[model samples]
Target: MSIFKTKSFWLATGMTLACSVAGVLLAKLPYVNLIGALVLALLLGIAMQVFPQQVRQTAQPGMAFISNKFLRLGIILLGFRLNLVTLARAGVKTILVAIIGVAGTICLTYWLSKKFGAEDELATLTACGCGICGAAAVMGVSPQIETNDEERKRENEVLAVAVVCVMGTVFTLLEIGLKPVLGLSAPQFGIVAGGSLHEIAHAVAAGGAFGESSLDNALIMKLSRVLLLAPVALIIGYWYQRKFVRRSVAQHQPTPKKLPIPWFLAGFILTSVLGTFLPLSAVVLDSFVQAAYIFLGMAMAALGISVNFRVIFQRGGAVFGAATISSACLLTYMVMMAKWFF
Candidate 1:
């Protein structure tokens, strides 16, 4: 039977949609925008774990479909949010800072996570979330990591996102408080915020706290880091496939027939290029971006439903520790870079 004919699939999909819509609505409440729809949806889904086993069983397939398929589609549409032209206008100094910051953070965070006893896949997801665009980065690179246990993979992804979100919120507050004492110019603070914060929203909030110039610089620096997602995803995919292929050979299992194709990533890159060159109106672009966020929220809700809170509690310590330390280091590095370059 076709997937569309499956009642359980439709039921699960409806649950995700309902949760996502609720998230979006909650975000519209005064000051609730700070939490954002994605995280809200994730929380709602996590709350669903208390539902009856029969209900969970019925929703499992559709939840998996939404988590994987909706996620990729959201990421593909997210490409439209990037305007290379705008990033270029932010200048070479901004670009360099973003590159160095992302690369350094990823390396540092991964090493710290490993030292804290996190597994390889968990460590990698945590690193990507810190170094790139937070939850989106984690979700984007997660599919590349070959894991026989789907639950384990989703759990890692959720843990990584939670760490990033918590760290990002803490740093956002820190940046705001420190801005008055740091005595840096608006643009300098913007660079620091954009380069260090885990999520784009975090950067925006921190940057906006200073001034308009800070917000602009922050967004440019943040989006510049976002632009690197494609290349990073490709590289990780290659490395993971090779590692898994070798493991399979050693165990006398059949190797994968072909290299994995990241069609979603390719679509992202293509969409970005077109958005940069095309004469699209701001309203149209913004609409597409909003749609992407909704889709991502739905995916997050689906992923959250599969997570066991007890498991998260057990593993949270090392992951959170790695993220906090790495975030602090990244903040210091960004401050130094801003003072020296901006």
Candidate 2:
């Protein structure tokens, strides 16, 4: 029987659901949740190989849309967990470090991508995703760029997800190992991990590995980093449009109208601000946000399964190099700021 049959569909769906549940449950554990989620995500990726074609086709369009849309919405809801006033109390230095880390990561990654022989579009997507907020960053910029080839677009998506998974896992393991070995303070570890991890979830996991205080600090730092997404997207969009115009003029083709900014990003910012003033119950809001995040994770896992694992491994050195250099620079910057300012 073809793997695309009903059994395969149900099996894949079940596995995804299981992975999501495991991720959330693990997240609640004292120190193990982050590593658990990373392991589970990887296992799900490997299990996805059983029905390769089905997983790829399933992950293509719907998974992409679900991962992008709900993840943004989730980030908006996550704002409720934050106390803007408290963040302000943490002072401007914390904010400055976050801004520098985000900007530095993007610039460094772009330079590293060129050195690694990555395509421009892929490099841009990878850098933004790594620099700002993972998958959401990629989604925000996708509409602005014209990726006419579906295959190339798929390749971009795969690269983004693969990097996030690998880097997120490494961050978690590092947090787990370093917290005990170095006897680092919660705030110090939080600053280091939040600055380095590729995704917010990974930051949370790393923070949790250190304890509640570290988790709270790390989440705040990570959110501050996330706030950079809008400005970064705007700058990238502007630069992309400028390049497009130059190319069009050089080729004697009519320049297209500029693409509208992603409305969801604006909504995310607005909701975050509103969350500060709203009287909503934390239980209800937290539950909703948690659900959204779990769904986003499953969608990402499904997306991961779609990648050609062999191809990714073949190009592993370059990918690892880019991620390592970018993360290292960001981490170093954050640590220096934390020492100087905090």
Best by lDDT: 1
| Tens digit of per-residue lDDT, candidate 2, span 1-342 | 543455545555565566667766766676555444534554565566676576557545544454455445554554455566767876787788878788888888878987898778777777887787666566555555565675556557667556756776776686567666655678878877777777777788778766888887887787777777777777777788888888999999998687557566676667666766777677766775676556555655655555555665555456557877887677667666656665
Collision pairs in model 1: none
Best by TM-score: 1
Question: In candidate 2, what residue range of length 10 has the lowest lDDT sum?
Answer: 33-42
Reference-based TM-score, model 1: 0.96
Write candidate 1's Cα lDDT for 233-258 as tens digits: 88888988998889999999999776
Q: How accurate is candidate 2 locally (lDDT)?
A: 0.67
* Cα error of candidate 2 at position 156, Å: 1.6
Clashes of each: 0, 1
Estimate the TM-score of every prediction.
Answer: 0.96, 0.80
